[model samples]
Target: MVSVAMDAVGERLVSRVERLRALEQALLKAGDRGVRPAELAQRLGVRRQTIYRDLQALADTDVPVWNPARGRWAVRQEQYVGTVRLSIHEAVALFFAARLLARMADEHNPHAISALEKLALRFPEPVREQAMRAAPLLERRPRNREFVQALECLTLGWIERRKVRVLYRSARGRQRHPYVLHPYFLEPTAPGMAVYVLAYEESYFRQFVTLKLERMSQATLLDERFPERDFDPVAALQSAWGIMWSSSPVTVRLRFSPTVSRRVRESQWHLSQQMEEKPDGSCILTLRIGHTLEVLPWIRSWGRDCEVLEPPELRSQLAEEYEAAARLYRTAATADSVSGLRPSSGRHPRL
Candidate 1:
C-alpha cells in the first residue's frame, strides 16, 4: 500500500544519510594519504560508481574534497568539522610545542596565537585548568617587531609564490646588498627560525640563500612569479652541519673521554652519526657532514675531554684556536704581573 511505500522511502533516506557521514569520516581519517575510489567503495560496502556520486554530492555541498594526487581523494583539513580528539599525553605535548612556538614566533603573528587558542579551547575543563596553571611557568621572550614585520612580508610572498626584492645584510662582511629572491620556506633554527629563499643575483642564476629575519632591512613583494622548481628542503640540508651549507661533506670523527661519553652517547647529535664505545669507558662519535664552522664551537665546548680523531684539517684548526686562546691568557697574566698585582691575591701590592 501507499503507507508501506512511505515507510520504505524514509528508511532509504536514513541509510543515505548514514552512508554520507561514513564517507566524510573516512576522508577525514585518511589525512595526507588520500583514499582511492575502489578502496573507499570496498570499505563502505558500496559500488565504485555509488562512491563517486557520493563524493560529487559532498563537493556540491561545499565540502572541500579533492584529488591531492592522481587517483587519490582526500578531504582538505580546513573543511573537516570533526573534533580533534587528543589524549592527555598528546595534549600536554601540543601544549608545550605551542608554548615554545609562542616564545619563538613573532608577537604580531596571529596564526600562531590563534592556533594556540584553538588548541586550548579543545581541552577538557580539568586539562584546561592545568594548562592555565602551567602557562605562568613557561618563559616567553619578548618579540622583535622588526623581525616580525620581515617574517610577515616574506610569509605573504611565499604564500603568493611571488618574487621579493630585499635589502639584506651579510653576516660575513657586515655589508648590505640588494637582491631579488623567490621566497621558498621558513626553517626553524636553534634560538628561533630562519627564512631560506631562492636568490637571483646578477652574478648568480638561482642560489639557495639563507636569510635571518632580523637582518633584512626591506622586503618588497614583486608581481613577477617564479616557476615552482623541484626543490626538496631535506635533500638540500642532508650534508649540512647546522646552517653552514657551503662546504663539501667530510667524515669527522671525535673521541670523547669517559667523563662525557654517557652524555654524548645518550643523544643523537647528527643524522649521519655513528658511535663506537671503547672498553675504557670512552666513545668515538663519527659524523658525515658539511661545513665544520658552526659545529666548531660545539666541539670546543667539550674542551680537553674531546679529541679530533679524523680530518686533520679540523684538528689543526682546533689546535690553532686553542693556542691563540692560551697566548691571550698568558699575555693577560704577564700584564697583571707587570702591574705589581699578585696572580692569586685580590689587590695589587703598593710600590
Candidate 2:
C-alpha cells in the first residue's frame, strides 16, 4: 500500500514538472512564430498526447496559447508583448506607489503622474476605479513649491548628464556656484521646513555639499561633464540623522518619554533606528549616524521628555539650542513688558 502511494506521488511530481517545462518553453518562444507539440513533448520526454492535455490545462487558466495551422503552439502577441504577470506582492507595491504619485499632483514631476497612469492602465476596470477613488483620500502635506521644482530640475540635469549653475543664499547671502555635481538624492527636514540636496560638488575638489533647497535662488543647467568619483551616497547618508556631520559614522542612543516613545515608534525617523523598551514602560531609541545635528532638534522637540543617553556632542548641542531659544523668549517677554505692549489675551502666538 505504501509503495502504491509513493508511486502516485512520483507520477504527480512528474506531471507538475512537465507542465512547468511547457510553460517556460511557451514564454521563451513568445515572440517567436510558434512551437510544435511534438518538439515540446520531446523536450519534456513526455508523450505528444500528454503535451496536448497540458496545453488544454494551460488554456483553461486563460493563458493565451494558440495552435496555429497544424498542431504547432504559439504564445499570442497580446499575452507576449502585453501585460506583465506580477506576483500579488509586486502588484500591491506598484498600487501603493501609484497611489502616492496620483496624490502628488502638486509635484511638477511629469513622470510621477504619467507612471501612475501607466500602472492604472495595466489593471482591470474595477481595480483602476478603486485606485482612482483611493488617490483623493490619500493626503500628502504640501511641499515648498519653488524647492520642489528646483529639485526636480536638478534631477533632470542629473539624468541628462548636465552641470548646473546655482545661485545659493546661505544663512549669510547669495553666492554663485557653477559646479559640475552628480546629484544623488534629497532628504526632507523639519522646523522652518528644509529640503537638503546631497550632491558631489565637482568644482569644489569633489566635495559633498548638503545644500538646503530653500537657499537655492537662481539655478541653471549647464552643458558640462562630471568626472565620475568613487563615492557612495547611500553609505555616506547611513551615518546621518540630519544634514550635519560627515566625518565618521557613530552609534547614537536616546531615551524617550512614554508619550514621545509611542510617537517615535510609529514613525521611522532614521535608517538605522532600533528601539528597546525600558522597565518603566519608557523607550530607549538607538540609532547609528554620522552627524550630531540630526538628533539634536529631534531631542529638543521632545522638551524635557527626551534625553541623550550617549554621544556627548549631540547632548551638549541640544542643551545649547534649548538654552538659546529659552533666552530669546525671556528677552522678548522682558522687552514686551518694558514697552507696555498689551498682551493679546485670547490669541496665542503660533510657534
Candidate 3:
C-alpha cells in the first residue's frame, strides 16, 4: 500500500511538469496575440480547470501572462525560458550594447528595459557582480518622452498593418502636414538614435516616405487595413545609402588614407561596397548606391583621411562645404582679433 501511494505521488509530479511545459510552449507560440485558456487546454489535451491551475502556477512564478482584452490571454511582452551562458567578454559587450539601447528606447515602452533586466538576471554570478560594479561607468541620457509615445502608436499600426494619420512637422521646414500613412517599419537613424517610420503615403503619391517620429505631433491608428503582399522594406532600401532612397543609382568611389584604410575596410559600409587595397597601404572603396546626400556626412567625417575619387558632383559639393567651413573659421578669427577677444591659452576662438 505504501509503495503504490509513493508511485502515485511521483506520477502526479511528472504530470504537473508536463502540463506546465505544454502551457509554456503554447504561450510562446501565441506571441503577442495570446492564446485562450480553452484553446490551450484543447491543444494540451487537458481540462479547462487544469489549464487554469497551470496558468496560476505561471503567475506565481512572476510570468507576465495576462488577459489583454476581455477573453484574450497573451504575454505582456514576449519572454523566453532558457539559460544563456556568456563569457565575461560577451557579457561586457552585451552590457554596453544594452546601455546604448536603453538610452534610445522609449520611456513608455518597457520592452527593452525588461529584456536587459532579464539578461542581467541570467548572467553568471561573477560576471553579474562585475557588471553591477561597472554600471556607474555608463551614462544614459533620457529619451524624448513625447517622441516615444508617438512611436508606440506607430508601432501598433505597423504590427496590425493598419493605416494611420499623422500630424507631421516637416524636416525641411517646421511646417505641419497631415498625412495618411501605411506604417510598415521603424528604423534607427544615426548622428543620434533618432527613430523614423518607413510608411507608404496613402493620401499623396502612394510613394514611400521616412518620417521622423520626433517631428510627429500625433499618430492615430485607423480601422482600415492594407494588403502587405508586395511591400518589401528590405528590397526598397537595397540601393539606399542610408535612409533616403533615390530612383537614379550612382557609383561613388573614395580613396582612404593608409592611416584610416584599415578602419574603413573593417566595417561593411554598404551592400554594394567593393574595396581594393593599394600597394601604398591606402585603399579605394566603391559603392553602387543612390542618395549621395545621406553618405556625404559619413565621407566628410573621415576629413582629410578620405578623398572622393568618382562622382565629380559629390566632390564639388564637398569642396564647397570645406570652403564654406574655412571661411567661417577665418571670419570668426578676424572678429576675435578685431575685438581683442583672444581666447585664453589652450582655448581656440569660438565660431
Candidate 4:
C-alpha cells in the first residue's frame, strides 16, 4: 500500500485544476465587453493578485488568453468549453442533490441553495422550477470539509498518475487499510447528501471502498501520484447497497407495514431493489447489500412493523435480540413477583 502523504498533495493539485477551469470559464465569458481582471476576481470573490496569477497560469499552459488592456483580459471563443454531458441517471442524481441542497436553508449555508440554482441552469426552464420544487425532500447533509480535502488530493494524484497513502479508519476500528485509489469520478449520493470518496482500497486485496470524508483524519498527499490508471466508480458501487464494500454479495429482504410501505416505495434504498406486493397490504422489499451491518440498524428502527425474511443470518440476529429481550422480561417478572409477595410466617420466626 502507498503512504498517506501522497494523498494530501494529490488533493491540492486537483483543487488547483478545478480552480483554473473555473477561472478559465469566467475569462471566456468576459468576452470583448472585456471584463477587468480585478472585476473577474471580484466576481469569483478572490483577490486581484490571485486572478492575475490565474491569467499567468493559463498563459503558461499556452491557451490563447491575454490582457487586451491594462486590467481587462479575455479568452478566445474557441477556448470556451462545456463539460461532458451527464447520463440520465447522473442527471437524476443531480436533481435529488439539488433538492437536498435547497432544503439546507436551516444549515445556514445560502450557498447550498445557490448551488442548486446553478445546477438548474443546466436543465430546461420548465424542468428547472420543478426541480427546485422537488429539491427539499431530497435535501442531503452539507459538504464535509475533510472528505472534500481527501477528494481533492485523490484527484491530483489521479491526474498526475501518482500513488497516495490514505490513513483510513475502518468501521471495525481494528482494520486500517492504506488506500491507493485510481480516482476518476465524483458522484453525489442522493440529493443534497455529503459526497463520499470513491476509490480503490489497494492493500492485501484490491477492492473499492467509499471513504466518508468525515471519517478520514490526518490525511496528507504524497509526491507520488498515479497517471493513466483506468477504473469505473459506478461499476464498483453498482453491486453494493449504501457504502459498505462487500466482496461477497448477499441479498436482503424486508417487509414493511402498510403505513410505511408508501414511504419505502417512494424512495430508492438500492438500485437492485425489487418490490413485491403482499396480499395483506404490506410491502415486500428485496435488495442485495454488500454488508448487512449497514442495514441492521435501519431494520431495527422499523420495530414490529418490519420483518427480515431472507438472509438467515440477519433473521437470526433479529431473532436473537428478540429472544434475549423476552428472557429478560420473563426474569424481571419473576423477580417482581417474589418482591411483591408478603413475608412468610417462617421469615418472622427466623427474625
Candidate 5:
C-alpha cells in the first residue's frame, strides 16, 4: 500500500492546538536526528519554555517522545505525517468537506472512512468531533460490493498511472459499455450528488469524458501502463460549469428579470462570468463554459425570473420545457383538482 499525504493550500491562521499538531509533525520528520527546543521555538515563533512544555504534553499523551541527550527531543512512530499542518480556517473548511464526502457517498467505502478518521485527529475540539462523526456515519451507508470493487480498481489505476477498463452503464439506458480510460481525476460533484471520474480515452482520438461512479458496474486495473500527462486538473476544469471539460467553450447568455437582478448582481457565481445591466432594470449574464447540461439545473432553479437568451438551441430547449409545464398547469386548472394536471397530449407550444 502506498501512503498518500495531503496538505491544505492557504494562508496560515495560528492556533495553539494547530501549533501542537505542527510540532508533532516536525518531530516525526526529524526522527532520531531530533531537534533542539531553541530551534523549534525559533521556527514556531514561540519561547523555548513553550516548546519544552509542549514536548512534555506530547509525552503525557503517550506520544512516544524521548530525548537521547540534553535539549534534543524526538518522536518515535512508524507512520509520520510529513509536513502536515493546517490553518485554523483550513481545518474548519476540511471539516465541512469531510462532512460533504460522508453525506454524498452512496456506498460504505472504507478508504473514504479511513481518510476522514485520519484527518479528524489533526483538528481541535468541535471541528474534530464533527469530523470524527463522519466515519461511522458513512459506514452505516448501504454496501455495494460491485461499486466498492470498481472504486478500488479505479483508485489503483489512477495512483499507478495505468489504464482502467470499466463497464459503464449510461443513465439513459440499461446496457453497459466498455472503455479503456486513463483516470485523470476522481471528482465529486456538488453536495448531495454522485462522484465522477474525469478520464481520457485514447482509442481512435483524444477524448476526455466524465464517467459517474454510480454508472460503473465493473472496473479492472489494466497491466499496460500509461505515461503521466503534465496536466493540472484544476486548470483543465477552469472553464467547466461542472465536470465537463473542453478545449473549445460555448458562450451561454442568460437574462434575469428585475426582480432577481439584484440577487444575481450581488454574487459572483463563476470566474468567467460577465454582466450587462439594461436601462429597463433587467440584466444579462454571459459566461463561457464547457457544456450546457451542467448549467441547465442552475438556470431552471431561478424559475421564470431567468431567461436563456443565447445559443438558440439552449433557449429553444428551455422554451420547450416551460411551455410543456404551462400546458400542464392549464390542464390542471381545467380539471380543478390538485392532482388534475394531465400530461401534455399536445406537442410543445412555441415560445
Candidate 6:
C-alpha cells in the first residue's frame, strides 16, 4: 500500500513538471499576444488556479514573465532571453563543436540536436546554411530509449543532489549489478565516443568511480537527497589521459622511432608530458598519469614505432602481448603451408 502511494505521488510530481514545461512554451509562443490562464489550463488539462501558481513559480526563479494585460500571460522575450551575436570565427568554432557533439553521441539525442539547430539559426550566412545542414546529422543515429531514460534520471539526480540506483555492467561484465550512486558529475570523452558519470559508491569502491553511460541501464532517481560536498572535477581529472582518475600518478616514458617521432611531437598527448630528443632522430616522451591501463591501447596503436622505456612492467606486458600475437600468426602460417596454401598470395601452391 505504501509503495503504491509513493508511485502515485511520483506520477503526480512528474505530471506537474511536464505541465510547467508546456506552460512556459505556450507563453513563449504567445509573445506579445500573451496567453490566457484558461487557454493554458485547457491545453494542459489542468485547473486555471494551477496555471497561476505555475506562473508564479516560474517568476520566483526570476524568469522574465508577466501578464501584460488582464487574463493573459507572456514571457518578456527581449528581456527573457537576449539575442546571440557571434563573430564569423566564433560562429565557425561553434559549428565545428556541434559537429563534434553529433559524432560523440552514439544515439539520436533530442537535447543536443535541438541546441545545435537553435545555435545555427542565429549564425552568419554561408556558415549558417552549413551549420543548419550539420545540425540534423545526429537524427540519423538510432535512438536508445533505455539509455535516454537512464541519462535523464542521472541528470535529475545530479541537479537535485540525490542518490540514484542503477543497474550497471562493467566493461567486460557478463551480468548487471546494482549500484547506489551519489551523483557528482557527468563527463564526456571524444575519442571514446561515450559519456561517463563520476560518483561516490560507498559499498564497493568506497570512493568515486567512473561509470560509462553505455554500460549503465535501469536508473532510478531516489528521493533521498545527499548533503553537498566539495568536489572539483577539473582538479580531480588533471592527470587523467582520459576519463580515468586516481590519487596516485606514475611516470611513463616512451621512445618513438624516427619514422613516428615527428608524429608524436605533432600533438600534446597529455598535459604532464615532456620530450627528450635523441641524437639518432628518435625522441622519448615522458608523462605522469594516474594509471597506465588507459594508455596501453594508445601505445599498441603506435606498433613497433613506439617503445615503452620507463615502466618495466608495462614493457614486459607489451612484449608478452606482441609475442602472443606473433605466435598466432606463426601457427596460421604453418597450417597454411601444410595445406598447400601459397605463403604470400593465400592461393593454392603450384602442384
Q: Compare the candidates by lDDT and give the number of the best one.
A: 6
What's model 5's overall lDDT? 0.81
Query: What range of 10 consecutive residues in model 4 has the weakest lDDT sum?
Result: 102-111
Task: Give per-residue CA lDDT, model 2, range 34-96, as digits (tens).
Answer: 777787878778788887887887667666778665756776643433337886568779988
lDDT of 3: 0.77
lDDT of 4 by residue, 155-218 (tens): 5655444555666776578755566665555454442244467666566447555666545654
Q: Each model's C-alpha lDDT?
A: 0.76, 0.68, 0.77, 0.68, 0.81, 0.84
Instruction: Give every collision pair in model 2.
Output: 239-289, 239-290
Could you give the C-alpha RMSD of every candidate to the true structure, in order shown? 8.5, 10.8, 5.2, 16.4, 11.7, 14.1
lDDT order of candidates, best first?
6, 5, 3, 1, 2, 4
Candidate 2 TM-score versus the reference: 0.54
The ten-residue window of minimal lDDT in model 6 covers 76-85
- lDDT of candidate 5 over 1-351, digit per residue (tens): 122222222223336668888889888778667899999999999999999898888777667888867778887542222444787787668767878888877778887888889888888888678778779988898888778877878777776578988788778988788888898888777732677788887763277777888778768889797887777777878888878877799899999999999999999877899999999999999999988888999999999999888999999999999999999988777776566655566787888
Clashing pairs in 3: none
Candidate maximizing TM-score: 3
Give stretches of model 1 more than 4 Å off.
Answer: 1-88, 102-114, 124-143, 172-175, 191-205, 331-351
Ranking 4 against 5 by TM-score, winner: 5
lDDT digits (tens) for residues 1-351 of candidate 6: 999999999999998888777888888889677999998889998888888899998887677889799888898754564335787677668778778989877777787888788878877778678888876688998888767777888887776678888899998989999898887899888868888888987667777788987787888888787776677777888888888887788999999999999889899899899998899999999999989988998999999999999799999999999999999999999999899986786588789
Q: Compared with the true structure, what per-residue lDDT tens digits does model 3 show for residues 253-289?
A: 9999999999998999899899999999999999988
Would you list the rank order by TM-score, best first? 3, 6, 5, 1, 2, 4
What local lDDT score does residue 278 receive in model 1, on the 0 to 100 scale? 99
> What's the count of clashing pairs in each model shown?
0, 2, 0, 29, 0, 0
